[model samples]
Target: AQSVSQHNHHVILSEAASLELGCNYSYGGTVNLFWYVQYPGQHLQLLLKYFSGDPLVKGIKGFEAEFIKSKFSFNLRKPSVQWSDTAEYFCAVMPGYSSASKIIFGSGTRLSIRP
Candidate 1:
């Protein structure tokens, strides 16, 4: 079975501050990685993803992630964060190429941005 781990449970930052959230998986074979963000009361939205091709993938809202195969990591990053970016970020993984595969999610990282 595959699992995702998010090291940071909560993160607080002021506007314009840089942000990075750690995410790791337990799978050793081909897998899919994704970052999803959920706002205060909104539905979960896809931030970024890495299936194949480039290891470095860019996402919406100035977000990006690097798929480090050797480290089994897909860390999310943003050069500068905004107050609107405040949300609960989740790291998810699905083993194999099947979109119907069960997607395992991390515990989630809550991000709070100061005005």
Candidate 2:
């Protein structure tokens, strides 16, 4: 079965610190990768995504992710962290080569940033 995995269950850091969240997927075919963020009390928003062409994609708020097809990984990274960056990060994968494929989201990684 196709699935997404986020290695970090919870991450803690101070302001200005760097952040990296590991994500991996299980599938043998083409897929669309996405990183979604849900703030403390806000709805889930797309942070970044990788479909085709360039494997590297940059999203809003200085967030970026790299799609390494060989390892089936799409890790999220940020140069600096802020208190407002505290949120739940979810790595989602849409199996198949089409845009209408079903999306499977990872359990989630809760980020805590202290000022």
Candidate 3:
């Protein structure tokens, strides 16, 4: 079955730590990949996305993700993570470009940062 996978269930780090979160999908056709972050008491926000152009895309707050078509993966990365980066990250995939198409979200990865 087509699905998005996030292998990491939880991650712990201190301030100024680097982060890499893995995301992979099972769909065989073209797909739009996204990473959404939700702070402890805030709504989800779009961290980054990949559709048709260059596979590497940068998002807000120094966050970025690289889409690898061959591996069916779009992994999120941050050079240095701060306490503010602690949040629940979700990897989502849309099988097609249609706005009506439902986006499948991977099981979230919870990140905790020590002060």
Candidate 4:
């Protein structure tokens, strides 16, 4: 079965700290990767996504991810984080071959940034 893994369950950092949340998947075929953030009491918002074309894709809020096929990794990174970046971040994967493929989400990583 295909699945996603987020190594960090919770990450706490002060403002301006560099952030990198690990994400890996166990799929053998083509896949699309996504990073979604859900702020406190808010709906999930798309942070970044990687489908085709580029291995490195940038998303909203100065966030980006690199899709490394050799490692089955789609790690999210931000040079510096803010207190407002506090939220639950999820790493998701969907098979690219199928239009109806259900997205598999990792056990979220909760980010807490101190002001």
Which candidate ranks first by TM-score, i.e. highest? 4
Enumerate clash totals for all models, in the order shown: 0, 0, 0, 0
Q: Where does candidate 2 stray beyond 4 Å?
A: none
Q: Please give the RMSD to the true structure for each candidate, in Å.
A: 1.1, 1.1, 1.2, 0.8
My TM-score estimates for the predictions, one after another, are: 0.95, 0.95, 0.95, 0.97
lDDT of 2 at 32: 87
Candidate 3 accuracy as lDDT: 0.92
Q: What is the descending lDDT order?
A: 4, 1, 2, 3
lDDT of 2 at 81: 93
lDDT of 4 by residue, 14-113 (tens): 9999999999999999999999999999999889889898899999999999999999999999999999999999999998878896999999999999
* CA deviation > 4 Å runs, candidate 4: none
* Model 2, position 78: C-alpha lDDT score: 94
- Candidate 1 per-residue lDDT, tens place, 2-110, comes to 7899999999999999999999999888998999999999999999889899999999989999999999999999999999999999999989857587889999999
Give per-residue lDDT, candidate 4, residue 108: 96
**Model 3 RMSD vs true structure:** 1.2
Residue 98 lDDT (model 1): 70
Q: Which window of ten consecutive residues has the lowest lDDT sum in model 3? A: 94-103
**Window of ten residues with lowest summed lDDT in model 4:** 95-104
- The pairs that clash in candidate 1 are none
lDDT of 2 by residue, 39-86 (tens): 998999999888898998999999999999999999999999999999
State the local distance difference test value for candidate 4: 0.95
